[model samples]
Target: MAEVAISDAQERSAESPALAGLAAAEAPRAPAFIVTIYGDVVEPRGGMLWMGTLIDCCARHGLNESLVRTAVSRLVGAGRLEGVRIGRRSYYRLSEAARSEFREAARLLFAPPPVPEDWLLCLSEGLRDIDLPLPWARLAANIALAPNRDDLMPVDGILMRAKQLDGHGDLAVLAADRWSLPEVAGAYGDFLASHGGLRDLLARNVTLSPEVALALRLRLVHDYRHAALSDPRLPRAAYPQDWPAEEARNLFVCAYVGLSKAAEAHVGAEFLSPEGHLAPHNGETERRLFQLRREAAG
Candidate 1:
């Protein structure tokens, strides 16, 4: 058995207030859509936007304006957003607590994947009942492995280098026990199938209407972000054979880059600034993300 150790710091972080209401409120479809919108547009672009601009952005995705308004109201009630009104104009910003949550998300999504130091196979009592931030996989009773140690949780458990074991007997089975490789791979596969053909068509120099461009862009980001959150986002070694992650990523890049100009045109024309003018609301955050994507493609 490997030596067991506990991390006090990790325990405190698990109960951190920044992550409140994430999984709970996101169960409903409208809230989920609103969260996606926040990730794609609101969070990155100076973190504040008018209510009308938000409604118009959702409208491109075929969401009703009233429905979008309701979603925003619920999000504010849920403590994820702050709503402000000046005269007749209304605006919302990511609550400071919510900003911390999404900042970590943005870091994970954009940074290059890193290899972990070691895989800790831990056996501890009351693990299921205890709240730790480990990317947990339950082995028999009172057993789990920390696949992600990037942010180690405060827990007492045996530790060992991943290379020390040949993954014999139970270890071989435990990897599967920890994460459902097939399901994660299958999600990537489904994502690729849904968007692949359109990506290829765009690659062949097809044109899209401004509405279509913005709508498709939102849909693609919405789905991709959801997948990223659900996935363990392990290293390439953790993937099963025939994993479609790279393929899905390619389709995402192709479609988003191909649609950028038209989508920007639409937002620039349709979404106005706080000044109530038809000025383009381009910001550095948007440019940086697009630049990162373009660099990744090349």
Candidate 2:
């Protein structure tokens, strides 16, 4: 990825001590609007959206038109949104790479070994105290705490049961249909920002044992597959039966590579196995997770 260039004004704003403190406090308060926009655009068959239409839609959610427009522009600048001009209006869509990144992000958020529900309960309480709208908070909490199934196939059954219990089956189906990568990413980012301990844990555990890492990776894959498959919009035709397995394997490899590279920055290559792998050590949480996954998979 190329480094982003910021203007002097932006640099100043970023450096201001007061603004920095405010940003730290506010970031968690805002859920992933950028990712949500991306998901809204991509979940549909067209995958392209008019900027004006998006602004109007966000307006219904109490977001200022200018704020929504600015957020879209920032996402475009970040390469997550590709701009296409038709006549006088501009349309934005996700690039292929952005889609892949969002897919990985979605997998991470809905994956197994879920985050604790109390984390979101605390966030919702904080938002309530500040008089913030509760829809986003409610939705985030639902996604995070949804029951995990053994595999992807059984997920649809759960969704169907949820519909039967509620009269708004169609609404539930519509909402599930709209779930997408960017939305998941935005929610995950928001959740992480709200929970300080989560951020600290991710930063500190850079050299997780391979066994533990694999377990975490598998859980994430399992949950992602289940979530996506349950959604009405994501049909089996879009993702074949074998796709989940393949994607899961690919994610594991990518995570392993990324973690190993990060570890190499501190521990010398000598600590790595002869085949450039990280072995499990006793007392590592990741190793325990790996064992749990083994039982789950079996």
**Would you estimate the TM-scores of all the predictions?**
0.76, 0.29
What's the true lDDT of residue 295 in model 1? 53
Q: How close is candidate 1 to the true structure, as a TM-score?
A: 0.76
| lDDT digits (tens) for residues 62-93 of candidate 2 | 45677877777777777777887777777777
Error of 2 at 98 (Å): 2.3
- Ten-residue segment with the worst summed lDDT in candidate 1? 17-26
Candidate 1: regions farther than 4 A off = 1-28, 115-118, 126-128, 131-134, 148-159, 164-173, 273-283, 290-298
> Which residue pairs show backbone clashes in model 1?
4-157, 6-155, 7-154, 7-155, 10-154
List ranges where model 2 is wrong by over 4 Å.
Answer: 1-31, 108-298
RMSD (CA, angstroms), candidate 2: 21.3
C-alpha lDDT of all candidate models, in order: 0.62, 0.39
